[model samples]
Target: MSDAAILCRFEAARSIVRDAADLAMAMRPPPGGPSGKQKSAQDWLTEADGAVEALISERIGALFPEDGFQGEEEGRTRTGRLRWVVDPIDGTSNYARGRSRWCVSLGLMDGDQPVAGIIQAPALHETYTAVRGHGAFLNGRPIKASPVTDTRSAMVEMGWSNKVPDGIYAAKMAAILELGAMPRSGGSGALALADVACGRLDGYLEMVINLWDVAAALVLLEETGARFSPFLRDGGLDRGITLLATAPGIATDLAVALAVPLD
Candidate 1:
């Protein structure tokens, strides 16, 4: 597709994702958390997930009938060279508990390349958008990764997944502490990576994460000059896999410490 076409879709997605996030906020659970079901040990599922996905799918399908659509709640509903991958409510656990950390994420892919993306956190009133070759923005202003080179001064977040064994996850967390950096787990892979892009955090890693989780943030990271693992090359296009995205300054050392390669 031409650059114009890509940018058109990107802009449309921004509006679409923002509306979807508002829909999620309306269905958000109360402060003690909703009575959500578990997809697994700690994985959460809420009505908002499917509701938001359906809204986005319907809107996108109506706007771009030929474009493919994929969602976390509903798998691929349509197929095309230009595909849109979405995580309707990225931090279900947080959203389910009435927290403000969850978001609605949508990414555009041209074949295997992530060309553009939009991540909207309605509860926080923040929106991040990026297009390959263009810059990344947070609520309309440009943003970039942090310049902290020393691991001792960095703050990194590691996302958790049930696919990883407890012992292995602990070992990786210990390794980050060994490097003298603070470690955190925000329960939202997309936002953590966006934090890396906008310099709120120095880096983000995950033992196992799905494409929809990072699809939108990947474009943001790339536009902001952050270093990350070769997720697609490592089979992220087809299944969940390990991911490590960091500011360029801490990328090398962090990768070595975590034993996860960077792109």
Candidate 2:
């Protein structure tokens, strides 16, 4: 598809997500219906996640029915070389708890590389988008990663998967803390990456993440000159796992500190 047509498709997808996010924020949750995945001792899935995915999937299908789809809530629909990876409600846990850190992420990938991306947080009124070779933008203004040279002065974001063994999780956490940088944890990988793209945070580390979680923001980061490396070659929905993304200055240091093996 032409770049203009692709951008139009993304705008439509973004609108659907904005509506879903607004609806989710307005509705009150049922008392004691479900808690976080940690407390529940199971992966948490919510009605809002499904609702948003359905709306987004339908919109994308209407625009590009031949393109494949892989969404967080709904299953995959593989068909064409161009696939849309989506996270309808990226930070479901935070959204469920009324935190404003979540967002909707959609990425268009040709083969294994993302070519176009959009990340929108309706609650925050923030929208980030990037097309390969076109640079990244936040709310229509272009953004770049911070030029912080010293790791000690950096504000970093780190995330851990509940599925990781306790020992590994602890090791990763301890190692990150020892980096002597300010570390913060939020619920959404997409939002965290968006922050990195806009220079809100200097870096982000995650033990495990599905493609939908970082697909869109990955393009944004790249366009903004942020550095990232895949811990695994296969980052499809089925093989989601470790990833490290950071500002260009600190990418190597953070990767080495985390001991993320090189390909």
Best candidate, TM-score-wise? Answer: 1
Q: Rate the local accuracy (lDDT) of all candidates.
A: 0.92, 0.77
lDDT of model 2 at position 258: 84
How well is each residue in 97-157 modelled by candidate 1, as lDDT tens digits?
Answer: 8989989999999998999988999989999999999999999999999999999999999
- Clash totals for all models, in order? 0, 0
Over all chains combined, what TM-score does candidate 1 have? 0.98
Error of 1 at 151 (Å): 0.3
lDDT of 2 at 4: 82
lDDT of 1 at 155: 97
lDDT of 2 by residue, 1-263 (tens): 57786676666766766676676666525444444443344356667777777877777788788888888766686667788888877877767666677787888887777888888887788888888888999989999998887788888888766767879877876776787778888878899988998899988878778888888988888899887775326554467687777877877777788887433
Query: Which residue runs of candidate 2 sit more than 4 Å off their true CA positions?
Result: 1-5, 28-42, 231-237, 261-263
Identify the candidate with maximal lDDT.
1
The pairs that clash in candidate 2 are none
- Candidate 2 positional error at 240, Å: 1.6
